[model samples]
Target: MDFLTITLPISGVAINPLLLVLLGVAVGVLGGFFGMGGAWMVTPALNIFGFPMPFAVGTDLCHMAGKSIISTRRHAKFGNVDVKLGLIMLSFDVVGIEIGARAVMLLERFGLAGLVIRWVYVVFLALIGSLIFYDFIKKRQMDKSGGDQSKSAITWHETLHKIKIPPMVNLPMAGVQCSLWLPATVGFMVGLLAGFLGIGGGLLMMPALVYLIGCPTYVAVGTDLFTIMLAGFYGAFTYGMKGRIELLAVVIMLAGAAPGAMIGTIATKYIRGYGIRLMFGATVVCAMVSVILKQMGQGGAASWVIMTAVTLMTAIVAIGMFKGAARELRERRLSHEPR
Candidate 1:
């Protein structure tokens, strides 16, 4: 293990090369599959493996820039990326992030930044996770009862669209015509939370896109990656300037992330929108649990818990991807068979 370890340039910490690779693979799969940076999962995992806590966000963001571009390009090939929506969201995110960062700075002056942020994180994660899980369960029950799930899923977005605020925008790619304020407001909120929490906003943005902006599941994933790519680059540059980023570590992680991203992007071709939502819900719940444990001051236990959840979620998604891909291949083969 000692010989397998290497020191990162900026962080100046020795870590196993293999662990970096594996972490990249895990987050890459999630990011590509779900259009998230997976920083929520990656941050704690890095801390557990002895990475400096302060440097974790910078390193993760640095890697996320590369990973998101790879994933976004792959998704674009599938016609799932909504470039217009992504750009719109990106602009608002910049504003929100600044506001949120400034707010955090103010809180720090009062000596309450850490505790306040942690509690808010716990609340946001728990609430959002529960809502997603509820939606998943509700859809399942509807399916069992032969009710219409699609109608139910879009009800919330539809209501928001009905607000009829001025400057409504038409998102042809996403198949939505609604107030521009909808996505702008959503992006700002996600950015604010991300800035305050010091993590990639993808985890928050995806749900908002799906439930608030009425983007198709696949489109939401791809567009989120588009936004994350730009944001990641900004985050990396700022953090790198502070000497918190390890370029070598980022390169090693990207080595594993590249392949994982390919697999994840390809998997989208076989999986349905609802299937993606369910998997995302599971991961959010995992994050929620980890936050709760952390708030309770179980630092050691929380790290392991996060690792377990991420490992399990990644493995399950990988299995699903392979199984779906295999089934598709078999179906194609059967269709091509002569009578």
Candidate 2:
């Protein structure tokens, strides 16, 4: 058992040491590569194991903010980040997270905030999962037809560009001209979801940046992290000011994730971008399924039924991605070796 300090009136909390470190590592890897709010795993695991909702969310936000700051800087240094695109993304993403946060507060008044969040996860998860899955399946068809395709296709981005709305913004990095209203509306919608789910919304943000906002895959991810860094920092400060942040847990997780982030970043250099996207899509899809089953259990379904389903899915995915990344890394090294 590992224990970590919490805010006043709570003192400290105990958790499984190995699991905590593992959580940091898994989230670090995904966040480093995917620019997501891995709070899906952290908050749920924390809540299930006994941490209060607010504390779990608060601490995770702080950790995410810190890690994002580091990751965004690293990506920027590597020329993977587009500051102008990131700045543009920040406007909408921040508005979305803040609006999302406010919605969470409103849902709290109704009770069933957890259940509502689960449903939100189900909807967003299903929608994004379908979209990602379709992309790969479409890739196969395109390949079979002998059509050359870019590494990351932008059919959706092009479709969006055709909409001739007034006051369109030319996002050169994204290579799309979208209406100002488009970003604001998307941001507000995402923000409402974030508030309701009490999440950083990275899982949704990255995909949105790519498909909806029309940024290149690498640029979208880097920009998403830059945007999420803002959300996390703001969320953390707000929670801390309200006396909800858990310093001890944040300290412990960061201690583990700092090294893990270094490893994740190094691994990123070796791993193919497509590989990362597939795994990122798979992870969130699994998480989405998990949240769905959790909702099923809440609706009086057999707890084990939902538990078994989610557990199997999560385990298979997490392990598969880990092994796949390791194998890819090995293959990349071999290819670079002196013949």
Candidate 3:
């Protein structure tokens, strides 16, 4: 392993460069496809691979800043990004992050930070993953019965939008008209969770945008990336100032993440919105399992579980993307044939 190891300058720790690149690639796919930074996946994976918790969180955020830019550019080409919504959410999210960070600091003073954060992940991952999966099942059943599954009838989003409040705003791109406070509130809460957990916030924001703010799944993904870019920058700067960042490791990850994001973003054009939702739900469920394993003190087992699950999920998403693209190309060729 000596031949494969590289010493990180800031942290002065030896690590495998190959492992960093692979982690970046897997996370890049998840981020690009789901419009998330995948901190939930990356942080634990990093910890398993020898990064201290602070270093893992900091380096992940640093790479995410660049990875998100690549993915967001591709998503913008498809007109999937809602810039206004993203900006609004970013503003509220930043404030939430500060508050959440302070709260975590307070908990750390009492020696309860680790236990609290772990349980939070358990609760959040379980609740959100189950809801998304259930919705996927419901939609499938509705499709079989020839029932309508439009925005107006899709769970709590419709009900939330119906709330009569001051300062109503319309997001034509997201195809919703609701109070501006709606997104702000949701963004703040999600940001709080992200900051407290030292994550990128995408795991929570994707579902929030789709279910609470009533954005289309595709739009939710794109917008989430835009906001996550800002969050990453903030996280990177804060963690760097605290001397917790390993810049060299982050650079290695970015090398793979740049191209991986492009691949994942392009896949969006081939797959349907429902397909993205299903993948998102499945990945979250996997993350939940990984977090549970780690909480049990089975460090080696947890590491293997996360790496295996992430690799498998990324491969599945990649395959779905390729298959969908191939089918589209075939249809196009057929339509162009002499007839």
Per-candidate local distance difference test: 0.86, 0.68, 0.85
Lowest lDDT sum, 10 consecutive residues, model 3, at 149-158
Worst 10 residues of 1 by lDDT: 147-156
User: Ranking by TM-score, best first?
Assistant: 1, 3, 2
Residue lDDT tens for model 2, 150-208? 64554766666677778877666556567776666666666666656766777777777
Q: Look at candidate 1 and tell me the lDDT of residue 110.
A: 100
- Against the true structure, what is each candidate's TM-score? 0.94, 0.78, 0.91
lDDT of 3 by residue, 112-168 (tens): 999999999889999999888888888888888888766323578777878768898
Output the number of the lDDT-best candidate: 1
Cα displacement (Å) at residue 36, model 3:
1.1
Specify the highest-TM-score model's number.
1
For model 1, the superposed segments whose C-alpha errors exceed 4 Å read: none
TM-score of 3: 0.91
In candidate 2 the C-alpha lDDT for residue 176 amounts to 58
